[model samples]
Target: MSTLTDRYVWAAVRSIPEKQRGELEPELRGLIADTTDAQREKGVSDADIERATLLELGDPVRLAAGYTERPLQLIGPRYYLDWLRLLKLLLVIVVPIAALGAALGRLLSGGDVGDVFGALFVTAIGVAVHLSFWVTLVFALVERGGVQRIKTPGDGPLLEWTPDSLPQLPAPAARRQSLVELILGLVFLAVFAGWFVWQQFNSFLTDADGTPIPVLEPALWSGWMYWFLGLIVLEGVFAVWVYQRGRMTMGLATLNLFMNIAFTVPAVWLLLTGQLINQEFLDAIPDTDADFDTAMSYALPVIAFIVIGVAVWDVIDGYIKAWRSRNVSDTAGE
Candidate 1:
């Protein structure tokens, strides 16, 4: 037999069970040989005959499936839609919950921003992988076992399909908005809260002895920083609340406005009162022509302006989202 014929026969039988391969390989080689002889008799060249024979047989994997009576796919058409729906449902429900749990655990364990985020990513991926593996395994078993519909003691077929069984889907735009808001809120809060603690132990600015020097006043740790951290936690909780609700409402938006004010007012006040930055750390600067006090006198107003501007934008954005959500609801109702 030609080398091409040998390769084709080998590829087709390679995946068949060992006991079956003994029978299938000889059968496959016979078919290839018979086809090659017929084509050669029709005045085809050896290379052309081999190519034509293999092409007629099509993909080796599919041919193997035919010989073995086994599916090439993990979940066949019978269970594919069901498996897909279940996987989507599990991912949407489980991933966020896993992320939240990981984030909270890391926070309570005194993890910094990097540690908390790393935990969230690793946990989400692990949960997703496990969910996919188990779900696929169960569906593959069902497909192989030739099970039709699962039934319960006092119920109709558990996997039966009906119009009434379809889920009421939320508005896609609103759902996406809520998710974005939740993610951004949680990330912002986590970074600031973690940074507040992390800065004390790690900094780019170091003393002459190479000790870390924090930019924020260490005195704030004794009192004001706790309040800021509390607000950060509250913001995180509010982010979850917004996502769970799936759309902004007037009441929720109002609450968001107040939360922004609560955070930014104190922040601006601290900046203006010269209570935010560490004077000692500034004095430790190696070489600078500009005076620290003169620089801060100009810098504080700009920082205050940026802070107030962000708070104002946040408030307005909340109201706008709430208004748009209300309008969408009204239109849907009508």
Candidate 2:
């Protein structure tokens, strides 16, 4: 066989089982030769005939799949929608529960802010990976086993698809909104980064010697501040991803949820532990009849409440926006 025929045969059988390749390679080469010969009889040039024969045979991957009677995709059309639906549902429901459990366990075990945050992050990621792997493995097996349908309680038959089941594409207005959100999120992160740096050199609070004292603990610069900034950058990247997609998805919403938790839990913990604010800045405050600690004891709960409330609201808002963007009636005539 010519070099072109050799290349084509190699590609086609490379992915096939070794035992089968022995049989398939010769047959494939023979087929290509026969086709080239037939084309040559029609006065085609040798190179042109080889190219035409390869083109007519099409992609090697597909040809190999045909020979093996195996699918090229992990999960085929038969279970794709069902797999996606189940995966999204599990990510939304299970991830948050896992995060909460991890956070609570860390808190109960007297773990510090970093420990709790780490636990939450690791648990969420590990659980999500496990869920995805097991769910996909199950579906792939079912697909290969030739199972036609799955019946779920309250969901009817999984195999039956309808026009009503089609996902609604985001409207133009929704795309515009996502753009606006992306811009605002980037701007906010930029301002936050600037403010964090600025406060280290200049702040309204000053010591007895008139030196500016950062409102945030300077000690955080050692490590925690970098983690906080990294989260901010991640949030900005996520915003761009959402805008590029032109709509919030369940996975994005779940990510937003974890981001919120990651930020808020540490913040609330820092505030409660008196580790968030500068001790020197606190000491510089003019004395009052009420001690600062007493004042903060009453104030910290309120501050924590507001911080947590905002995070919770943001998470809920993301899910709502995702739902609205995906429901046709929600954006109709807009």
Candidate 3:
């Protein structure tokens, strides 16, 4: 009767040994039914009753832990190394890139040093929050049994942790996350950031009337402009980092995938709100008699689709590179 209860039971049993599922499922269901019925005898509504029942069972992951006789740490000793490796990898790769992008963007825009540092400070915090939240969440899922850990370096029958056994050594092919690529990426980032900032400051492109119309309408977005620029800078930085790191790990790929999503979703929303393009530019097109609203209806969806496609490709590309890097490593090892 309770879908929530069913979901909870399934989630709790999912991480345990499969042979135990048959014995546990019915037992779990009966337990849910009893709890729900008892609550129903009181004045609790169906929703609240369902919530209470699930609460009594505790966290689904922890419950699964109980069944499997596993400890309930956010990440167990078995996975701590992998989790830490990923956390450090992302932080090392993401933070500097983000900060540098912000610094470069702010500086090229003729912003003062204080403002540039301010931007860097904000970017660092933003990147750290993103890394911390996602890394913790992934490990939490792994803890709950929703995620499975892949073997890391030195994971063998007699594996023991040591400074000499540190997983910092990337596979031979992974070394392809080359400095040359990073330098090239930095150039591209600088150009893109400079271009956008230039667009913000000047309107070199004009209609037949010789009147200047800005590429982006400044006033159309009162508060969102800052966020949009930040997004652009964040993406640029992420690209720089990705290009530098020839080898990608699963966690790193996943983080980048979600970063692309996080960046795209809000950007798409802002674009859909009809705030992305300048109305003045649209109206000023000498040959086109189309008004702002009419032009938007025809153009926005196409633009949004393009943006979405690019974002999706970025996410996929990260994983593809990771796969290729792994393949290269495997071949070299053989």
Candidate 4:
């Protein structure tokens, strides 16, 4: 007469080790059936037998916990220390390599090596701070049973976590998060724009003569190329903001990313090529003007193509995002 309708109990039954599940199922079913038979013979009503059987088994959640041997916590105390240790290891290995490469690049390119080194130092700290913040949050949530919410395909049956089991983030905290993102986005855009302008200014000062500067400087002609980089970076920032705000359509965001890559490839290619050709390197001598001209003729069109492609993509991507957001707003209103 007794039946197991609780999802947690059923999930636990299914979660037993494959060989164990096969054996446990028959035994548990026999016990339930035998208990019901005994209860009926004792003159207990069918409903009472069912209720008593469930009661004796205790809370389904606790019972399930016993059967499911897998760890249900994502970042428990055991993992937290391990996570920090791994992160420290990564920082030690990656940061110095990045710093050394960046410092060497500045030295070769005739830029401020001290400034580049300082930037590397800030970059390392920034990376650590951001990674630590997210890791700590994951661990905090895991401490409160957050991992149980993740149901994978291999999981035999669903055991849904109730509202009481879910993490509750406060409205003030959510608003503060929004504010922080907005500030960060603005800061990124401002920094990118500033860099673009500075490059253009330096190029203008050096391009006074028709001849190429002794070193690679973004000059009159090269100043135009920086626009391509600026457009790509700006579009990227906008796309990211829209994504975080949940206003970005998936198709449009993908398109934006593609546009960014398209713009990025040629500009970066030319910049790298310039670096390789510059007299500072151990390449095959003066690198004939004919070779440079040949390279430019091929490179300019590719850069132009990417620049145009990005422009068109940005306009289209922006319109698509606006359209989708408007549709969502209308649907919500109706």
Question: Mind giving the per-residue lDDT tens digits that candidate 2 earns over 83-149?
Answer: 8769988887898789768977987899865886788789989999999999999988876776655
- Cα lDDT for residue 5, candidate 2: 54
Worst 10 residues of 1 by lDDT: 161-170
Give candidate 1's error at residue 104 in angstroms: 30
Q: TM-score rank, highest first?
A: 2, 1, 3, 4
**Which residue pairs clash in candidate 4?**
203-218
Among these predictions, the greatest TM-score belongs to 2
Model 4: weakest 10-residue lDDT segment is: 161-170
Q: Of models 1 and 3, which has the larger TM-score?
A: 1
| Model 4 lDDT per residue over 23-81, tens place | 65555566567766777888888657765555555444335444555553445533443
Ranking by lDDT: 2, 1, 3, 4
Per-residue lDDT tens digits for candidate 3, residues 32-122, read 8898888888878965777667665655555566666776444664455456658887787788678767866886697754676588779
Please list the residue runs of candidate 2 whose C-alpha ends up more than 4 Å from where it truly belongs after superposition.
1-72, 76-85, 150-159, 201-212, 221-227, 249-255, 286-302, 319-323, 326-334
Question: For candidate 2, what is the TM-score?
Answer: 0.61
lDDT of 4: 0.50
TM-score against native, each model: 0.48, 0.61, 0.47, 0.27
Backbone clash count, each prediction separately: 0, 0, 2, 1
What candidate 4 gets wrong by more than 4 Å, as runs, is 1-175, 200-216, 219-223, 229-233, 236-248, 275-334
lDDT of 1 at 187: 89
